[model samples]
Target: MINKRINITQKNFLLFLYIVILGLFGPVVYWVSNHNTQLPFTGKAEKNPIQKRMSIGEKILVKANNDAAKQEGITAFAGGDYVLAIEKFQSALKRVRNDPETRIYLNNAIAATTESPFRIGVSVPIGGNLNVAQEILRGVAQSQDKINRNGGVGGKLMMVEIANDDNNPEVAQQVAQKFVRDQKILAVVGHNDSNASIAAAPIYQDGGLVMITPTSSAETLTAMGNHIFRATPSTRNLADTLANYAVNVAGSENVAMCVDSDSQVSVSFKENFTWAVYNYGGKIAPFDCDLAAADFSPEEIPSQAISLGADTLLLAPSVRKVKKALEIASDNDDRLTLLGNHSLNTYSTLKDGQNDVSGMVLSVPWYQKAIARNSFIVNAQEFWGGGVNWRTAMAYDATQTVSQAIASGAERQNLQQTLANPEFSTQGATSEISFLPSGDRNLQGGLVKIKPGKKSGTGYDFVPLNMDQIIEAAPKPSPKGATTNPRVKSK
Candidate 1:
């Protein structure tokens, strides 16, 4: 009986061991079987030709969860069967709607099947601000579609590929390196932030590649290099427009300022606006507030400004500090005229500061209502299912500028020269496109005032201010020896 029990116990123990081993290794075996890239037993990843072409992170991002159709499409593209590549890419997109890489591949494949094709890189912060990234991409996509449909630039179709820099300076440098290495990519369209642009400008200059920024407005970028160009107006242009309106038109020459010190564009805007204000016969108030400071008191700043003889409160916050700027606006409560740099022209302000920021003015590079490019507007709305913003317009202009340069048969060696030539001019979404010696756009900024409206779907809209509104908002002396602008306040 003791022998029988020992045999049974051994059998049971062996069965339990087998079950535990199966539980531990079942998923591993399944994964190895499912993934063709894994060697059966060596436990090493074997990259295919397409995976081998990508960086490790890029391979993970692209192929880790990538569908079979996308893999097939990539293979077809590598094989130079552009028609098959396009078909496979389109099929892949139907399943993965928001895959920017797939969209870029599709665009490139379509361009390849055309008579003659040229490639450009559209670099943006796809991982950081997806909305801004998509906005810029829409502009490029629209321009590509329009140009190709209208017979392209001198019969050469423009193909675009998306590069996600994630808005980090280090990543932007990496992207710039990659772009410079790809000799086929003659021009690049972005690096949206000023810091990112500044970080990558030298790489582009060294590589003899042309890089045009659609939204970066730092003054430093103006002198970076001849290879660098800006489609958007500089900080100086934005400041001049706002300062002129505040000093000459609105009679709010004595301005108190709130600045974000952490942002390059914000600090640049503050310096330029200060000089412009003094030039326009205005003075910066002594009580300047730093929005980025940990001890920032939005509520206290306004009352102090009013007490210190400031009739205008300039909110020069960066994109990161717009919330604090809006807080200052709300706390001010119609006591002083509110004005801000282009950074404040955000959907957040329109939505969150509905009544508080109603009468506040913001400087922007482009506004669709101000410029009546009806065809571009109508087609963009039809394609994007809504209206686009200044970023989109500037991006369209940048893409158009590159297309024109490419159309002139300018390759990497001569593209910068072609763009910098005095006679190089092309029509853009905002206006005529041309580069100055500093590579800044020959453009001015426009001012828009927030007003109660349903157009923005936020119970308010950024209405382009007319001359009458700008000139008629000068403050009058109140009975209590205070300045008041009843005309500029929301009712």
Candidate 2:
């Protein structure tokens, strides 16, 4: 009985050992077969989690390095060390070429280095009451100095060089050619008169240089195919606004225009004024004056207005001329109401006319009183050490616009292409200025009516003109093919 029990126990123990061996070997065989099995779609092994995790970590590290490079580049750029900034940006690009921010800094550095530094070229009139031109240039110089102090466009110093065209079309053309050929300037800021600008347009177009006129308002300029730009509204719009305001708002029935015959800007103003006056149920009588005439008398203008039976007169001339015209108009008829252009909006002009300009109305894009209290304005003034003029503000806006375009990765050659972009809108100082495909600024208008006085309390009170009011009051267009005035060919 003892021998049989020992045999049974040994058999049971063998069975138990066999079961343990199968349990270990079964999983190994199944794993090998499963590893060899092809996936239905990919025919490859499933992705490795360990490898994917390593790749993600590497990507994050690269991103961190790129960010560090970008921050270093901006600091260098802001400090005006464009060379260092360029090197840093190029290194960053090697790691993150697809980054938009990296591309902007690279382009800006290229532009700053490639263009002439500390130099600006202007095509402006040489003589004939150059005070306005002088003031504009002075303002530009001040702005350049300020910008350089703060680390210029890309932290480089800037200088402006003025070129005189003597108000002669041929001279203007020659000067523009010289600016491009000899100077290789990147941009121009003048050729103040519309006639001068038109004459020089072809040269600037060929050179691919940008031009921003502070005063030119010819409608044709708005269509110049080059990178031409202007801060003032077009003459067509100005005339329409003035006439509409005169007849509709001021309640004038009879209007007369005293125009500067020798001035192209004046001729444009007169033609547009006539169309607006007649379209708004008002009559217009025209009087022409030689802008070059030294002994201009208010009596001469009054005689013309009296003959036309005009109760309202529009004077479109430079500030000096406007002041003289106002004096003549007031002397000729105290009952006469004066309507003027943007040239009359300055404190210098208003001060010259003092009580003479009491009731005259003018339109402007911005007013000092309106902006004086704003923090941005205050900061701008403090930055520049005083009140900033319209020209300075325009320059500021232009610089900001250019910087924003660069920041958005716009090519130096195609800066204008980014004018309509939302980034440009966000970068400007005063207003959100975006460009129409036509190269004109999309901006709003403001109106200020002059009241008599010297002190802050009585100098001028401005009423903001709503966009709807401006649109409704705009002058109607003349009938098709009806010429208000003969187109004067540029000399």
Candidate 3:
């Protein structure tokens, strides 16, 4: 009985040990069966969830590092350190292969680092006619500041070295000559007046310097060929538009043309005005005045309009001179209707001679009130504060255009090409502008009539002419053998 009891105990102990071993190996056996493999349970297996989360965190850290490197690269490029910028950018690109912003920065850095043989210099008449030129420069400076703050043009800040011309043609020529001889300056912006621009044009062409005039309206400047460019519309275009409006819209068959003989703008105005008027089947009763003549004598101008029975007068004198001429003309005949250029459209006309210019018509390329609410105008105004002049908006547009072209991979030699193929148009305070093939801005010149105010004591009010009506009134030119103006003899 004692032996049998001991055997039972041993059997029970072995069974318990077998159960314990099976419990431990159960999970391992199941895993092995599921994976179609054998199990080795010597070491513990890791939980996959924890390992996967850790891997994800590591990937996020790498992306953050790449973004940081890219930002640093952009900073380096803007600071003019191209070598460091390129390395950092390349490193960042490895991490993020398809970033447009990164690609732009890289392009800019490359352009800056690469040495070019052509060096272009731009000049501005920052002084003289302090109101106009200063306003222009202020706009230019502000625009440049904005561009530099936004990482510059293709990573290179435009360094403009300004020299004052003092509004003197001789001084302008001398300054231009200096820039040409330096070989670093490839272009000039100034000689604000036509006389100054014309004087410096030969020098610029001879020196291979591109002369871009912002204000000169000389007819001869455009004839200088590709070397010269002007941002302002030619007086010729303005004059033609005015003449068409006068003969067709105003219904004036006979017109008296008066021009300041001494002024280049006046010369251009006379030439274009005469051509456009004659082509439109209107007879011109001519009168020319020496703009420098101080006297207000009508004999000095010697108008043939009165003798020829013309009731309408086309006045192409300076704003100040026009006021004098109008005052003189009013005394002679109050019935004479007056027509003028955009120069006469000013606050001074309203302030100085409200009665004299009460019923006159003029053509202008831009109107300030038309674009006063544009965001660019608002931001530019805010940025410039009281320093913003109405004309500065045009300057801002010009500068922005140049910067954008450069940023778009325009080489120095290919500026004209880039300008010709401008991919963008900017809204300025005065006008929305894009360049045409002739470098003339694609803008509409409109007629505005100065009319007496409804209130007896109030100043004259400006009324915009009906553009559609004006277009319809003008005689359609025959496509086949249209009568063309006789070309004026070039001096």
Index of the highest-TM-score prediction: 1
By lDDT, the best candidate is: 1
Model 1 segments beyond 4 Å from truth?
A: 1-105, 114-116, 370-373, 467-491
When 1 and 2 are scored with lDDT, the better candidate is 1
Total colliding residue pairs, candidate 1: 0
In order of appearance, the predictions have TM-scores of: 0.77, 0.63, 0.63
Cα lDDT tens digits, model 1, 1-491, are 99999999999999999999999999899888888552322312253222232321122124332787777777788778878888887888788665545665677788788776877887887666666677787778778778887778787777776777767788888678777877778899997888789999999999899999999998888687899999999998898788878887778858998988877888788877877777666788888699889898888998999999999999987666788999999999899999988878777889888899988888899887645657778877666666778888889899989888878888888999999999999998857999888899998868989889887799999888764455356443234422322122321
The candidate 3 region of ten consecutive residues with least summed lDDT is 52-61
Pick out the ten consecutive residues of candidate 2 with the lowest summed lDDT.
52-61
Ranking by TM-score: 1, 3, 2
Q: Which stretches of model 3 miss by more than 4 angstroms?
A: 1-128, 138-142, 182-187, 293-304, 318-334, 369-372, 380-390, 411-413, 420-438, 442-444, 451-469, 478-491
lDDT, candidate 3, at 450:
78
Per-residue lDDT tens digits for candidate 3, residues 1-491, read 99999999999999999999999998888788789452332222142221221110112212223587787785786577878887887787677653323433454455456555223333444344434455455555555556666767665665444555655677777666666665444345555667777778787777655666666666677666555666667777778788888888788887876666766777787788877777777777745445456654664343445777777887776533556655544554455678877656555555566776777888765444544476555665455443233345555656666666567676545555666665755554456657666666665566777777642234666667776677876785444313566445554
Model 2 per-residue lDDT tens digits across residues 332-360? 55567888776665556555566767777
Displacement of the residue 351 alpha carbon in candidate 2, Å: 3.4
Candidate 3: C-alpha RMSD to true structure equals: 29.0
